[model samples]
Target: MITSSPPFFVPMNVGHAVVTGGSIEIVGRLAGQWFLRANFTSQLARDAATSLDVIYVPRRQANLELSYEWAPGSAMTGIVTYVGDRFADAANTSLVPGYLLVGLNATWALGEGYSFQAGINNVFDVTYQESLGFPEPGRTVFMAVTKTF
Candidate 1:
């Protein structure tokens, strides 16, 4: 007769890892009053032993911003950001899906070395998670006034 035993699992630290990636960015003025800035990044992170992707490392990411200056002291801007999917565990069994976020902001020079600024982040209030069981913030609004000496 032959008997079999269930497989056992052990956790160990990785000795080394190989990560390779590149990023490209562009910034320029558009149409005199409009400005654009964009960037994109892609990367591959793998464990040397198992050749599996590293946990919490996204494969791709990007950001874009467009701003318009309507007046000498006032400007409005829109922003978009993207994060790619990534593994949440060492074995690469759990995956956190990609997410996109949008935002809008404005700034005005109040004169006398002062400025007023306001912005809204996560415009759509999309629900997403970057890590297991941890939820990120959504739909945040902020305002501030500053004076310089």
Candidate 2:
């Protein structure tokens, strides 16, 4: 959707778009319960093109989250991602935009309503920018713990 009015001139933008492909899931339980779900996704972007310049970005990615929960205070999870050809190119970069990244997350219940969680981004410590020229954190370890009354 594109809308323009008087007073202010908003050149051109991607407007809004969403593109998705599909995925498959395989699950089972024996002695303990486990769940694995995957998703295949793509992006639909609008690159403002005028009489002078033309730009467009097409992003393709696939991600998966495999996790298992056993004891009350123990849960482990692994995240994996894969990018298409475009993302592998040096010109294509970004943690969110078009790039290849992998991360992991884990949680602990703490047994008494108190739980702790942690995650590490850029698992391989791969140095990459999120928005082309912008700098993004590398091999970061983020942790947060919470308790309920």
Candidate 3:
């Protein structure tokens, strides 16, 4: 039996999609002055109809952060991140390679809600893409000074 009602059809969410994943996080002190933390995720998000992988959804991703307290109210933090390969489209036609990023930040807290901060990202000037057609930014530096009343 076949019946056609309209030329145009609208898509609706029938709750047929399912995504499963798990993450692990660890935080601890390295020696006495440094704090270390890490996180990892393994996931699979898919569409039931076409049985295709989702766009920009990597199966594996992880990050790490290390902070050192050189003195009171002053700290330096370093971060590392990894994103596994993934598809650009639903059908998985276009492939995007995995990427790693490194960053560093330093913060100094002054008296009376005053602080100074600076950081640099993509320290190696890595060339990569975070999405399909968009190119990710390369080595960037930023700084900020804050005063609160």
| Best lDDT among the predictions, by candidate number | 1
Report the poorest 10 consecutive residues by lDDT, candidate 2: 47-56
| Cα error of candidate 2 at position 149, Å | 7.3
lDDT score, residue 99, model 1?
96
Steric clash pairs (candidate 3)? none
Decoy 2 TM-score against native: 0.60
| Model 3 C-alpha lDDT per residue in residues 7-104, reported as the tens digit of each score | 22223342344578999999999899999999999998776666666656789999999999988778999999999998765556778888999999
List the RMSD of every prediction in angstroms.
Answer: 7.4, 6.9, 6.3
Off by over 4 Å in 1: 1-14
Instruction: Give me the overall lDDT of model 2.
Output: 0.57
Residue lDDT tens for model 1, 36-103: 99999999988887788877789999999999998876899999999999877677887889999999
The lDDT per prediction is 0.85, 0.57, 0.81
lDDT of 3 at 107: 94
